[model samples]
Target: MNKPFSDKLRAVEPYTPGEQSKNNDIIKLNANENPYPPSPKVIEAIKGFEAEKLCLYPSSSAYALTEALAQYHGLDVNQVFVGNGSDEVIALSYLAFFNSDKPIFFPDITYSFYPVWCRLFNVPYETKSVDKNFIINPKDYYSANGGVILPNPNAPTGISEGRGFIEDILDHNRDVIVIIDEAYVDFGGYSAIELINKYDNLIVVQTFSKSRSLAGMRIGAAFGSAELISLLKAVKNCYNSYPIDSVAIAAGVASVEDDAYFKNTINKVIRTRERFSQELKGLGFTVFPSHSNFVFASKPDVNAKSLFEAAKKENIYIRYFDLPRIDNFLRITIGTDEQMDIFLNFIKRYLSSLSGC
Candidate 1:
């Protein structure tokens, strides 16, 4: 009796985050975390934060930060909902929008958190398959349902479905909520924030974890019509009233103000990705067209599993998924130019030893 978990949970496959190691010498490129540090202004803001404020309860509304987010996105404060991270915002979405009778629909290959949310909340859900190239066809999500959520540049795949594809879904699915998880949009995809004014059904969730380099602070946000934001706010109030803490709020406000930081960082990542993809092609690997900060690569000549093991031996680690259709591919995050240079040299030497290479 002590060992048995909830029946719903038994069916759920929990998300496996990338490996974080205490070994400092390893060149880690598994998760799509930003390779750079936070903006200088963000560091200054956090360092200047009042120490005595820690004893006080943070503002429940996070009004100042919400307004900063609103000003940045050209939205009103009521249209923005700040949370601990994009994960919390997603959890609230399920509670506020989903019912047991209706199912949450998403691309079969998407952010792994989608299915976990449904299982945790006891919400029914179904997966819709992506196209052969791992691109999401908009028509697959047109069915009448409880709700839907998919990342713009979907995780692991690093492919994006543009604003028009999302708008097409909004035109028909106006009754239920639609969540566009823009966790990686800062680098590749155009934002759907403009559609929020026209479509009350749409919700666009963003995170500072990727672009702003604030993964440790856990700052995430969502944008929707005032009516929908109110529901998320309600659920959040009941769960954790102070999800946005004092330090995080201070850091978040600074991140939005420093627009040049993202522009520079994203531009660098894009340049590195272009060169990296070209190099991979020369190495006989098929690198998927990517807009995000990582590349999903596959080569028929080499075994993907063996390559992953070999990299670990070289003290370098990248992501390898055991899922259907993509088990042979490696999702490699774009690291610094120096890091990539090291990776490339080591990999080339290893490739020469392989029978195919």
Candidate 2:
């Protein structure tokens, strides 16, 4: 029998997201979601939204959300492009700018979506290995390539590099598009949005999911020079004329306007993350210094898979990757202080049981 799918589709492997459990009783620290709720204004916006607007088509450009993001980042309206999420924005970017014969470059253990998008788009790519500590070396990215995309305060590891490091990479790759995925930058990492005006080829992509508590809303944007942003808009319009609906637009705009609440929630998560990392270290876990909302850690004597199973049995969910170089590691999102305390207690009891003490 002949297979219906094309060879390209057959060869491609998709990106697997973190497990989403339906049980309300479970402490889910797996997906790096903001444990906080959306801003009060967001709630107000949704409640006050006109139900009659559902029959009408939303703004094809997602103008309101794009304008809010532009104003938030101190960029012009032409310099911002909005999408359903940062993932869509990035996938469109891969289509818009990464058509060169040369292979693109990204860190080996960075966001797993980079390679998936490459295969999906048929874009040739190469992975540059991060150092033993899982830190990206700017020198490795200096080589000639199609383009560059990396998550600042990288996923899984949650380690971040500063502006100077990004500048070094940007200074070298002037000809190719450099996308700085800042989905987790609101937690602690410095943003490349500030440098967008300086580099024509740079595009800084961000999501409202992690920091704005709008993962359900699915709003994301990219900031770049008007020329690059226009290209992304072209690609986006070709695929989905109205990626963001009116409700999401209202919610995203409200989330951006409430600066105080955003900062307050971010600070709370940062404090919790720091305290959690310290607690993990005290438990003999080798914890990576994190700038994102999560910490990546490993304990030499404990099996990560076994620990993950143990936590799952207790209704505590964290991320465990069964991939190379990080098979022993666990990526735990920073939940509320109370939640962290509960998880810490669970860890303590689990370790105690292991020793029969």
Candidate 3:
């Protein structure tokens, strides 16, 4: 019998998101989501959203949210592009810019989605391995390639490089598009938004999910030169003219306008992350220095897979990559203080029991 699926579809492996549990009682920390609720203004905006607007198509350009983001980042309105989420934005970007014969480059241990997009788009790509310390050597990116895309405060590892590091990459690859995925920048990483005007080849993508507490809303935006933004919009319109809905636009605008709430929430996550890292260290786990909402760690004597399974039994969800080099480590999101304490206490008891065994 003949298969019906397309050859490309059959060959590609989709990206796997963190496990999501529907149980309300579970201390869910697998996904790097904000522990707090969205701003009160966002709540009111969603509540006050006109139900009648659902009958009408949202702005194809997502003008209001785009305008809010442009103003927030001090960029011209034409320099902004909004999408369903940062993932969509980055995926569309891959389609728009990574079509050259030369392969694009990203860190080997960075966000898993980079390779997925490359395959889906039929874009050739190469991975530059980060050193033993999980630090992406800026020099590795300085090579002949179609383009470069990497996360600031990279995923799983959560290690962030400074503006100087990013600038060095831009300085080398001025001919091709360079994307800085800043999904976790608000946590503690320095943003590349300010460098947009200075580097026309650069595009900085950010999401409202992690920091603005709008993951459910699915609002993401990209900042770049007007020329690059135009290309992204062209690709987006080809795929989905109205990627963001009316309700999301209103919520996103409110979330951006409430700067005070955004800052406060980020500070809370930072404090909790620092304390949790120290606590994990005290427990003899090697915790990677994180600038994002999650920490990557491993205890030398314990099997990470075993610990992950044990945590699942207790209704505590965390992330564990079975991929090589990272299988021994666990990626734990920084939840609220009370939740962290609960997890810490469970870990202490679990280790004590292991010692007895």
Per-candidate total of colliding backbone pairs: 0, 0, 0
Off by more than 4 A, model 3: 1-9
lDDT of each structure? 0.88, 0.93, 0.93
Worst 10 residues of 1 by lDDT: 1-10
lDDT of 2 at 201: 91
Task: List ranges where model 1 is wrong by over 4 Å.
Answer: 1-12
Residue ranges of candidate 2 with Cα displaced over 4 Å = 1-11
Question: Candidate 1, residues 186-207: lDDT per residue as tens digits?
Answer: 8878789999999998999999
- My TM-score estimates for the predictions, one after another, are 0.95, 0.98, 0.98
**For model 3, where is the 10-residue window of minimal lDDT?**
1-10
Error of 2 at 2 (Å): 5.1
lDDT agreement of model 3 with the native: 0.93
lDDT value, residue 216 of candidate 1: 94
Cand. 1 TM to true fold: 0.95
